[model samples]
Target: MKNELLQIGPVTIYGYGLMIALGILAAYMVVVHRAKSRRIDPSHISSLTIWSVLFGFIAAKLLYWITQWNNIIEDPRLLLELSGGFVVYGGIIGGILAGYVYCKKKNLNFLQSLDLFVPSIALAQGFGRIGCLLAGCCYGEETNHWLGITFHESHYAPNGVKLMPTQIFESVFSFALFFLLLYIAKRKKPDGFVASLYLLFYSLGRFVIEFYRGDIIRGSVGLFSTSQLIAVLVFLATCAILISRWIKSNRVSHT
Candidate 1:
């Protein structure tokens, strides 16, 4: 894996950072296009995006610090390290929370806003996972299969090992989910259905992916990894939301 993708005198570009930049740009474009279709104020989206980017970075860094609390206790300077160790779920949570607050303050329809962003979020995740691949951050376990990817002098994964290309697998899955969500959006089922389904599908996929994740920094409790625990909780929450919506619909129809 190569972190430094390109470099010139007094300037350098990192693979991970570049992928993230591209992902954000692509996601914002999708958001703007979708917002126009939904009749949402594009200016509101622009403002919310500023909040999302700020809070997402902070949350990602905060969670990473929490995961490495022991090291930080030993050396506080590690907290300022501007490279690697970010948790994707943390960023999503932070970004969503920021959006929620912004919507509330702006008196916007939360579910509709979610509908506009979920597909974009999925697309962004797909690209972000490719960044993980290039940085060798979220690597997969060893495998003897020819399809496995090998790295040399990676910052995280073991070098010279044929690992399951889990990053690529997750990237493909995210993209598939993105298309599915977008297609479902076209059907216009109900408010929040697409968003909830996005959460359910992503949580389930992430839970399974945790099994193949080679890194130990992901933190675990009992038999479940941190992300797995989150996935289970989010899955249950999504189920509750869907069931409640169904019950409400039934009651409204009966009335």
Candidate 2:
């Protein structure tokens, strides 16, 4: 759980940040390969990847600041400490919005682009979670289970005891989702179908995983966590898209 991966001179590389960069690079490679296979313009993949990373980082920081506004206002220095603090939901929302706008401006097929990128996003998320594990952030509650991982002497670990390895669990889950989506991609289904399924499943996974997290809870509305609130919104949006597609398909079939 050591945060610093390496230090050379005045520059110190943090494991979390390094892992995030690696994840983005991995996702970019996957997207490029897929784009080539689909006969889509491969050049657009680089542009999209760059935009996604830039916007995604901004969104993550913005959302984290919003959630911890009181602390951030009291101590503005927290912003300088990029070793920790980021919300995945914000990145997803921002990346999708940016990608949609980019596709529209270029007169590209937005749904198809989303379908192509969904799995790559999942793969990136999986690697990012590994970074979280190494940094000891996004940790889980203390447990005596066999799966508990100790993060003693870690800056991100609150207590010097073993805890559930929630980060690893999430990483594995996201990787599984990535492969599942990749397998489904071979079927060549509807335009938004892959993206919709990704949203639904990822939201469900996040909702369940939030319960294991021991981080400061931002309180919940009714029975839902703050993450669950976002997940519900995503799930509903996916459902709406699927329903609209179904209606359109039915009409086309009837005609």
Candidate 3:
């Protein structure tokens, strides 16, 4: 896990930032391609992506800050650090809200927009997790089993220990999810179905994956970590939305 990809005197390129940048590029490409297929204007897609990503970063940092409030209060400088530590859940929440606002302002159908973008989100997540692997942030519990991967140089992960490659597992799952959702979309499914499925599937996967994660940065309460609790809530919310949609569809069909 090499955090510094390149350095020239005072300038240095970070692995996490580079991966995030690549993820954004990949997401933008997929979004624009899907938008064209759906007859959505490419310019609008660009604007939406730019705004969503900007707000996503802001929201992610804010949520991370909230989680580490005690540390911030003690040092006051941790808040200003430009290093790693941005919660994915926070970014998702912020991106949704930001997308909602943009869609409303542009008079676009929000759910449909979300459907078009959901698969790309999964693809981007897969790449982002790869970034986590490179930066050695979201590590997994130490294991002596054959599946365990060692990160000897990672500052965040324990050196010279066999740790579960949870980041790689998550990356693979996200990529698989992207394909699944993309197939669902090609079937011409309901507007919000893909987005709802993404929430349900990703939340459930993240909850299970959290068990293997060794990162101590994530806060926990009782029997679940912060991400696990959020995952449960997201799954429940998605279920409620799906139920409501089914009820509405039945009523409309009856009429």
Candidate 4:
């Protein structure tokens, strides 16, 4: 739950910011390696990566502001604080849209690009969860379980007690998903299959994990968590996409 990693000559480096930088670097490396394998000009990926990350951050902040509209209205300055509160789903939506547009303009296949990007996104998210753990945000409800973690002096912690450590749980799950996607990629499944599977699995993981979150929660219709609402929508959308692809594949097989 330590925010400040070190101080040097009156300058303080925040753990959260460091973790984000590391995540971006790790994602970039994966993207470059993937581009090389596909024989796509790596420079195109480099350019698209910049746009994706820039838009992703803006979308993440915007979505967080929307979620915490009351707080932002009370203190506009809070919007500038990058320490926490960013939403990963918003970032993914924004980044994917930006990347798709860029790929279309360059005459690249959108599904192939998405297949290359999704695993890296999962890896980055896994790293970002570590940041959440260190920054003491996105924590879990108190528990007597052996996996409990305590963030005693952090802003995200309501009570000075041990909690379920949901951040680490998500991180481990995402890391496993990352490897699974990489493995599935080698199998040469349908172009968009890996990305669709990524969305399905990630949304399922998020839906389950949101139940254990101890932070302030927003409700949608009928006792549903805000994230749960979004997850359900995304899950349905993913199912539609998978079904459409299956139908197309079947038609081609019959042809």
Which prediction has the highest lDDT against the true structure? Answer: 3
Per-model TM against the reference:
0.95, 0.94, 0.96, 0.94
Which candidate comes out best when scored by TM-score? Answer: 3
lDDT of 2 by residue, 1-255 (tens): 777889999999988888888999898888888898889887788888888778987897788778788887899998897746888998998999999999999999999999999999999999999888888888898889999999865777675788889899899999999999999998969898899989999999999898888776343557776677899899998898889889999999999
Using lDDT as the yardstick, the better of models 1 and 2 is 1
Residue 158 of model 4 has an lDDT of 58
| Candidate 3 residue lDDT tens string, 42-76 | 88898889888889888888888887888789999
Whole-model Cα lDDT of every candidate shown, in order: 0.88, 0.87, 0.89, 0.86
What are the runs in model 1 whose C-alpha is more than 4 Å off?
A: none
Between prediction 1 and prediction 2, which has the larger TM-score? 1
Task: Give RMSD to native, each candidate.
Answer: 1.3, 1.7, 1.3, 1.7
Q: What ordering of candidates by lDDT runs from best to worst?
A: 3, 1, 2, 4
Local accuracy of candidate 4 as per-residue lDDT tens digits, 37-99:
789987888988898998998888777778888777889998788756777788988999999
lDDT of 1 by residue, 58-167 (tens): 89888878877888899998877877677778888898899999999999987888888889889989999999988998899899988799999688899999998989
Residue 228 alpha-carbon offset, candidate 3, angstroms: 0.3
Candidate 3 error regions (>4 Å): 8-10
